[model samples]
Target: MNIAVSIAIPDDEEKQTELSFDELSDRAKEKARDNYRQNYPDDGWWDSSYEDFDKIADMMGICIATKQVPLMNGKNKSVPAIYFSGFWCQGDGACFEGNWYPEKDPLASLTKVMGHAPNDADLHEIAFGLAHLSERCNQLIPEARVKVEHNSRYYHSNSVSYDIDLPMPIHIQEGNELQHMVFDGLRTKLDLDDEAFETEVSDLLRRFMDWMYGLLEEEHEHLTSDEVIDQYLEEMKFDEDGEAIY
Candidate 1:
């Protein structure tokens, strides 16, 4: 996450004298270093260098978002999702991808919430909802960064990774499966009851969903019908039972 690279586009003056990344001489590199030191003069500043201008431009266009989406299945669990996406003129018109961290003990979470392990249908629904939520979150949210514990990538054996951010805001929504499940679980686990729990949960869910739908509409206005449909199909994952899978 600390891997910082400077892709600063120089001003007209700097541009006129800019050296290519591949052709920079020892003196130029040294001067860049000294200039960085003099200008930044801060700790944790990594070496500054040029990437391909177009690639740098494309990367600069990237946007990030974090979302908490409730699963439609498995007692309506909620999970965290992160996304990186943007439009670029240099290469692909629009590109995006992201990752989500599933609940560590989903079955246990279900049991705690629902009083029993979910059957096959419940499990299928959960998987479908989680996947659907992730896709929707990525598609619906743009240019927003998710909160994470640290700015680091969660590396996998396949060498693929996603940057993790701090926790996103928690909104207990109205008529939300996640809210009911969580409250019910806590109520039973802790033997506590609050009469306003449902109202509070409903309010949170409503606010979040409304905000998301607004963003979704705004994003929709930017694209053609075909593009929207294409994106939807691309993100949709289906199961054998005609359910969407994550």
Candidate 2:
């Protein structure tokens, strides 16, 4: 029952419940609503989804001559397309054949990239909506390094993520799902109130359908930002599902 938002573009935390939505206006209120919408949609934007990995791989131009990835029935809860990039291929064409290993591929000059979690925890679809985003970021937040955790490609490679900063004022720290859980005491909050709350949450979700579709379409585009992300994920031979392609 606690709502949160972040002003840091990639973060959030709540101030106080005493402040009504009306008390804030213009940029403050619009930002609040956007944050609210991002976390809790009317129809649960975080719901489970069909993940077309082969499709995702093809989009990133991964080798598909084999057409048989470890994934056969398709994956689920794929990350936002915004999080991917592609890697270069080798003379052997294993990446295209889907026979390359993340830890041993030779793609140092490819253009196609894909998105991958900084680690494997990102492979599962946790209720969606940036669930563990805070936990992995905790150690790095104090030093302004948020992207490192999302890399998922390396266990402890000296990656560039460490170079980026993710400092959020403590005021916004509460917007983090972890901090919010601690602040709100999540255990005693989900019972009898379900019936009355279900519909409202469902409606809130419809608002983001357009956003999701746009992301999917963008990810599938012939050219995109994901190409770069995938390129980085390539250092570890990670595939679209965040699994080691080999």
Candidate 3:
């Protein structure tokens, strides 16, 4: 009796023991990008960049209210109450509720960062409007107080509202005819009627909110860009199939 046996062996060149190094690297990089996106699909990645905005607001004489949060060391830290949405979508934007005071030269402070020579007419107008409002408020309405608040469910610039309280001057309260005449004349010269005053304040605040949104958008774009993601992925590791390793 005799028996016959047959065996088939796979070609060595056709078998892949592991992905090529370059291919694995490329896949890993892509996987990293996916992971980054998953972790931060929207505005979740802007915390680190928000400090710059807070500083800018302060320089512009805007005092943002702060909330106290407990730290790991059992101490409380104050964080600015800055609110924002996104770079896209109709209702997605930024706004803040805070107190604004007159700075020595707010336009200079703004230009130092937002550019000295702005080509955008709206930006130029907003800058000058805010400056002029600040000057007039400081000189005429010394006792006037303003509070900015967000009134809409959406985050667009128009959602912000201003509450400006202009107290009558002491001389006007005393009811002197001469003082009344003088006050009326000054108010007229400064174009400070109630309607005009409110309009100017509202315009300045809404425009400033728009500018804040622009800054947030620029920072968001930079953080989510491929180059930035690659920098973040430098320490990441991946397995042969491009799956991320712990």
Estimate the lDDT of model 2.
0.29
Instruction: Estimate, for each residue in 1-246, the C-alpha lDDT of model 3 and write its tens digit.
Output: 798888777796565444332446666667667777677635335556466656756655677777676877999877776677766687888877788776566557567535643565665666667667767766676666668887888887788777778777665667587877877677778877678877777777777778778867887778778887766555655566655554
TM per candidate comes to: 0.17, 0.17, 0.72
- Comparing candidate 1 with candidate 3, which one achieves the higher lDDT? 3
The whole-model lDDT of each prediction reads 0.32, 0.29, 0.69
* Model 2 TM-score, 2 decimals: 0.17
Candidate 1 residue lDDT tens string, 1-246: 599788876685462332332244555434433433332323211112111211221222212233344445745422223222222222212212332333233343334323332343433343343333333233322222321222334211122223433222255566698876875665444322233322322232223223323333344344424343334334444322323333
Off by over 4 Å in 1: 1-193, 225-246
Task: Locate the minimum summed-lDDT window of 10 residues in model 2.
Answer: 92-101
Per-prediction CA RMSD (Å): 25.8, 31.2, 5.4
Error of 1 at 2 (Å): 84
* Ranking, lDDT, top scorer first: 3, 1, 2
